[model samples]
Target: MRVRRAAKGVGDFVVESIGEAVAEVVLGVLACALLAGLALIAYLSWSFSPLLTVAGTGLLSLFLAHGAWGTFRDPVEGRRRRGWTAVAAVCFTLVAATAAFLLLYASDCGCL
Candidate 1:
């Protein structure tokens, strides 16, 4: 009876805990993407027109917030792979670099 009880407990833990952790990771990655977008907007505004800078920043922020909420609505479970995380990081870095470049280059051109 004790062995059966332990097995049941382990099963429940696996089903419940694993799901929550996966959701957390997914949301976390989404957050990183949004942050990268914001940084990109900042760089744009600093380098170019105020209108575009504000619009870009606002759009990215809204999209990220929405994505975050949507992601949490569903539980994602499957093969735990490192590829998604790597992809997220790469994307964020690209956004940041692009923003920085635009801002710096535009400033030199006297656009902003």
Candidate 2:
């Protein structure tokens, strides 16, 4: 009985450890895809008119925000991976906000 109990405990620990690693991997992949998507959207929209550029980025921001919420809602169990995804979210927001601001400013100037 003692041997069996010890083995069971070890097994549970291993399974739980794997769960955290899986969470980390899943969130990491999501973070990579998100960054790539944002990059693609920016590149594709670069040549569009100022209004359209802002619109494209605005849509991207919505999706990114939703993803971030999801990340926070069910966060990864690993510290390192969670930190990375958080960094990715921050980077996306900063770049998107800057682009949106610049696009709006340019459009306003163009109107004048």
Candidate 3:
């Protein structure tokens, strides 16, 4: 009886772990799909209107940077602060680069 109970418990644990792994994989796939879709939309918008796309992306980057700054300022137990700081820096760079590109290449597009 003891042997049977132990075997059942082990089996249950293995099944539970498998379920959690599957759930994580599914969620990861969904996230990738969502990101891909967003990238496609951004690309289409950029092709349609470079200025508008750059403006929208710049605004988004600013918001992301602000949020990252706020998170970084708060005390965190782990390495999250470093990650947030990197995000903030990347966002700032993105905004600056986009603006520079717009200014340098503005004459190429007669739409402006």
**Residue-level lDDT tens digits of model 2 in 1-103:** 9999999999999999999999866655555555557567777777556688988768767767764664556555663335545665776667667566545
For this target, which candidate reaches the highest lDDT against the unseen true structure? 3
| Model 2 / residue 63 / CA error / Å | 14
Candidate ordering by TM-score (highest first): 3, 2, 1
Please report the TM-score between candidate 1 and the true structure. 0.41
lDDT of each: 0.61, 0.65, 0.68
Question: What ranges in model 3 sit over 4 Å off?
Answer: 69-112
Q: Which residue runs of candidate 1 sit more than 4 Å off their true CA positions?
A: 50-112
lDDT of 3 at 25: 64
Model 1, position 81, has a per-residue lDDT of 23
- Put down candidate 3 lDDT per residue, 1-112, tens digits, no spaces: 9999999999999999999999866655554554556568989998999999999978876777775565547666664545656677667666566556445544244332
* Candidate 3 clashing pairs, residues 3+ apart or interchain: none
The positional error of residue 57 in candidate 1, measured at the CA in angstroms, is: 10
Using TM-score as the measure, the top candidate is 3
Model 2 TM-score, 2 decimals: 0.46
**Poorest 10 consecutive residues of model 1 by lDDT?**
103-112
The estimated TM-scores of all candidates read 0.41, 0.46, 0.54
